[model samples]
Target: MTSSVLEAQKLGRKYGRRWALRDCTIEIPSGHVVGLVGPNGAGKTTLLKLASGQLEATEGAVTVLGDRPAATPARLARIGFVAQDTPVYSGLSIADHLRLGARLNPRWDAAMAQERIARLGLAPDQRAGKLSGGQRAQVALTLGLAKRPELLILDEPVAALDPLARREFMQGLMEATVEHEFSVVLSSHLVSDLERVCDFLVVLVDSRVQVAGETDKLLATHYRLTGPRRDTDRLPADQQVISASHTDRQSTFVVRTDSPIHDPAWTVTQLNLEDLVLAYMDKHTADRRAALEVQR
Candidate 1:
């Protein structure tokens, strides 16, 4: 089994009266590509910032590589972060960024950085402000990779890129992971992109972690059951219902269980990653509705 590269316990972050993230607990295993999936305003950026030590948690704790985040120089050196905007010095050239990276990081991979820039066809002397969106993103990614951290955290890194650039970036990221044997935690609401590059998955909704586990295991265990309208209480306790919908004549439930389902009264169908994620999101929506009803 893979050891956890990043762990959070009851983690939370608040902005004034609003909670950006709350009761968020997750474990990202070492040496695997993990995907953080959530809609806008889902606290995905907040969680990533916490891991990168850019933002302090309002409560609970977060650890990266077995040490508290931002606790020591060594701890900080072990993580690489590329923010959602992929910030770069607009006035600086690509070579200038490499020079700055070498000065700041003890383990900077100068050769690797140079090779990647060459491969991307980015001119070493060309200013960052002059590059296209995709080119700029590539430069930012190169800088992150060259730092040679044990864990790399990316926040919606491809959201602004064209489809082709996104594919190339993902391909490069995968290759780098294989070559360096490092772990990654990438945030994106686009299930299609995550599906291609990540083996582990974490789904967050409404500032809380809905579910997190290995992608294959999650897909294999979750199933949809449909049949005559019936109360959920009638199903075996072993079938943990994730989401449910009902009509006068029919009922449907998304469930997770380790035991084999043999009931003839229901039709069981498997869920793709997108389907599974949406079910959890729907469950969260239902929970909010129920809370509102209780308040009335």
Candidate 2:
């Protein structure tokens, strides 16, 4: 098997006349909890669906666990997906779901499923439709975990949960990760939630991948530089500017570089994950404005 859990090459998915996701290229390494962060309408869900084989790409290719997604029963079985709503069969009881999982998944862990339901204090006979939203989410997550997949993709799985429920769900996920050595790609608009769990980060904006890398490496390489007003062209070529703003007397820029910044004229500050994500997102917005202006 390939070392990468998921790989997308110039992947594009269009809806009607507009592309929901386009020119996306990313390779997610195995054994890391990856966070896919973006705003609403950012194609976060589209990309996840492509990876899980729920949607076909209009252009390019996407591979999950080193094989083309949904290539065969075995390939499809290797991935577990929990969508934004944490969909569950409303008519089925929690126990019925377990039985279905066992009947369908070759690698289903019946013991794990029973233990998780018991620990969560969910009644075996409780129909999914009767459960609270959070409870239903838990049941969906339990089913995903019990499938014993090599890779799991979650698309805003806790977006509708209460704060306490969200915390509990995340806690259970972390515990399961510790117990099972599997890869996860979790999509969320909430950066704070991702900060607590993911080691790898991918920031998407306007249906494009703005930046992607290990969280620690990204944090180390990105910085905010403040100094006297200067043209962006004057900055060192190696320092890639993510965003820039200027006043009459000063210019501030967010840049990514591995080289040391020894400029005595500038004051540099380290950026947290939120800062970095916003910087890239803002840059994309600015670029769009510039493009529109040029057209006019």
Candidate 3:
């Protein structure tokens, strides 16, 4: 088994004159449920597609399970991809979809699939088009899981469901992961969803990776400091400011540093996952505006 389930070195993709994803590099270790978080237009779909071999990268290289993604039939069999919106054929019944999966995948587990459907209380004769949004998503997930892939990539699978539905869907997914022991890369714009299920995180913004690491480590290294007004240039070299804001006589900053903070003038507090992700996103936005100002 490969230590890393997915690896990319400066991977990128473009269409016409616009680059959808650029200078993207990340390595997801095996046995993790990695959450890919970013706003809309962050190129999350493009990156996932590249990983699943649905689209080729215009530059750089990507490897899945120590081989090029989707390089062969056997290689493809080991990776499962569920695209955004949880698409299912409207014309096919639940049983028909399972039949299709069995025919298409060499490692299909019909009994497991049937068992999952039965547990979900879904009738085999029910048409996919007649199912609720959550039910359809479950059906799609069942198909992906039944393939028995080493790695499964899900693109915003629960984006369209209601709060209750989302929770239920995620609960099912987490349960399946524990039972199957497969690596997963799930993408979403909502932090709350990822916060509940992911151990690893990757934040993408402006078609680039803003931050990527284990969630606990990221939370530990990042701190929020509040102090009397002071210029960021005066901060210690080890402290990298991610985002900053100032009032008339006070300043607040989110900083990343491995060393302990001993400053007596500032009060430091730990940041949550949402705070850390937002700080990086804010820093990226500020930098882009600064670059635009320089051009003007």
Global lDDT of each model? 0.92, 0.92, 0.93
Expressed as tens digits, the lDDT of each residue in 116-171 for candidate 2 is 99999999999999999889999999999999999999999989999889888888
lDDT of 3: 0.93
Candidate 3 pairs with clashing backbones = none
Candidate achieving higher lDDT, 2 or 3:
3
Give the per-residue lDDT digits (tens) of candidate 3, residues 1-296.
Answer: 54998889999999988999898888888899999999999999999999999999999998887889866878789999998999999999999999999999999999999999999999999999999999999999999999999999999999999999899889989999999889999999989889989999999997778898999999999999999999998999999999999999999999999999999999999999998999989999999999999999
Task: Give model 2's TM-score versus the native structure.
Answer: 0.93
**CA lDDT, candidate 2, residue 140:** 94
Q: What lDDT score goes with residue 21 in model 2?
A: 91
Better of 1 and 2 by lDDT: 2
Q: After superposition, how far is residue 23 of candidate 1 from its true place, in Å?
A: 2.6
C-alpha RMSD values across all candidates: 1.6, 1.8, 1.5
Question: Which one is best on lDDT?
Answer: 3
Query: How well is each residue in 275-294 modelled by candidate 1, as lDDT tens digits?
Result: 99999999999999999999
